[model samples]
Target: MDWDKLRIFHSVAEKGSLTHAGDVLHLSQSAVSRQIRALEESLSVTLFHRHARGLILTEQGELLFDATQQMVKRLEATAARIRDSEDGVFGELRVTTTTGFGTLWLAPRLANLYKNYPSLKIDLMLEERVLDLPMREADVAIRMKEPSQADLIRRRLMNIRMRLYASPEYLAEHGTPSTMDEFGNHRLICQQAGAAQVAAGAELVNQLMTHAVASTLTVNNYFGVLQGVLNHLGIGVLPDYIIEDFPHLQRVMPDLESGEVPVFLAYPEELRHSKRVAAFRDFVTDEIFAFRRSRQTE
Candidate 1:
């Protein structure tokens, strides 16, 4: 019930050592230990199991820790919203997206965002995992599929498809695969069949593999596959959006591509008014528009 004690308990549970938690809280080890003991006495429950290496949370402690973790995330979100109300767009914006979209598309265009709001700090989390926006695991997300969470503001950024491409030199040297049957003559670069990816992408790779490709190079993420393609390793199955940045790459069998994969930008509804979130959302929307315009002219 005591906020101070709960805070200390949360720190100790996170650090797994009273001393480590004390260092973080700027309290003496004895003080932290005393607080923990007092909290356990008040609750009449053992919160941690003490051992040689470190402390492990008991069942009751785990429940309490989960509640406190939620509290921490919510408090941080509130603090960020409050700070946004006071100043220019100047704070950390945690953005989550797939590694392929994050590295290949979003990260490259962020310089302009920095130019406009130089004080903004971007914490870009690049992974396939869909972070919980409502729980504040991340402030914003750009995902390959529509987010189903009900309490979020979602925007369909664009649609993308997996298409085959190869470096000009590679196509020149190895020759282009004019038909699906010719795929066997060149190496096939793609994400691993079972790796986390949009279903359309995997299906595209599966279709290619059915052609009995001569050799293959599989990477866990599209970034690595792009590298393999750029280095002239093979014809790669890549997102169509990426081809704009890599104009020299030649599309193989232009008509062949995976079904559409919708891209969405989403954030917790609470962040609708946060300047940091708004700035990031606008920046991405603008970039997508610019990308679309550039592609139309070409």
Candidate 2:
């Protein structure tokens, strides 16, 4: 019930060593051990199993630790909200998105965001895993599909399709394919069928492979696939959004493409008023608009 003791227990459970937890809490090892002992006495339960290597949490400790972790996340979110100023956006803003989009798109455009809010610190998490925005795992997310997560403010950013592309030199050397049958002449570069990717993308690759392509280069992410295409390896199945930034890539078989995948930007409802979140949301929206305009002219 004591907040101080619970805080110490959470640290110890996380670190699995009294000394390590003590160092983090700025307390002596003896002091940390004493606090843990007192907490166990009050709860009348063994929280950890002491071993020569390190402490392991007991079943009860795991439950308590889970609760503490949630509590900490909530507290941190609250603190961040309190620190945000209406007049200026500053402090750490955790943003999550797929590696392909982050590397090929968002990361390159971040200079504009920095120019506007120089004091803002952005922690960009690039992975396929969808982080829990409501649980505070990440402050904002740009996902390939509509987020089914509840209690979040969601915006449809844009729709993207997977299309075939190759370097001009590669097409010139290999001769551009006019149909699915002609695709067999060139090596195909694409994300592996088993890799984590949008279903539409995987489906497009599957369709292409049915043509009995003679050679292939598969990467786990679109970034690698783009690299392979850029180096004149072969025609690659890549997101259409990439073509705007990589104008050197010529679209192959314009009619052959994947179904549209809707991109969404989302944040927890609680973060709707946070200046940091608002700033990021607006920046992404503006970029999307600019991208659309550029594509129209092309």
Stretches off by above 4 angstroms in model 2 are: none
Give the clash total for candidate 2: 0
Find the candidate with the highest lDDT and give its number. Answer: 2
Determine which window of 10 residues in candidate 1 has minimal summed lDDT.
204-213
**lDDT of the structure predicted as candidate 1:** 0.93
lDDT, each prediction:
0.93, 0.95
Per-model TM values vs. the true structure: 0.97, 0.98
Give candidate 1 misplaced runs (Cα > 4 Å): none
**lDDT of model number 2:** 0.95
**What digit string (tens of lDDT, one per residue) describes model 1 on residues 209-244?**
777788999999999999999999999999999888
What's model 1's lDDT at 61? 98
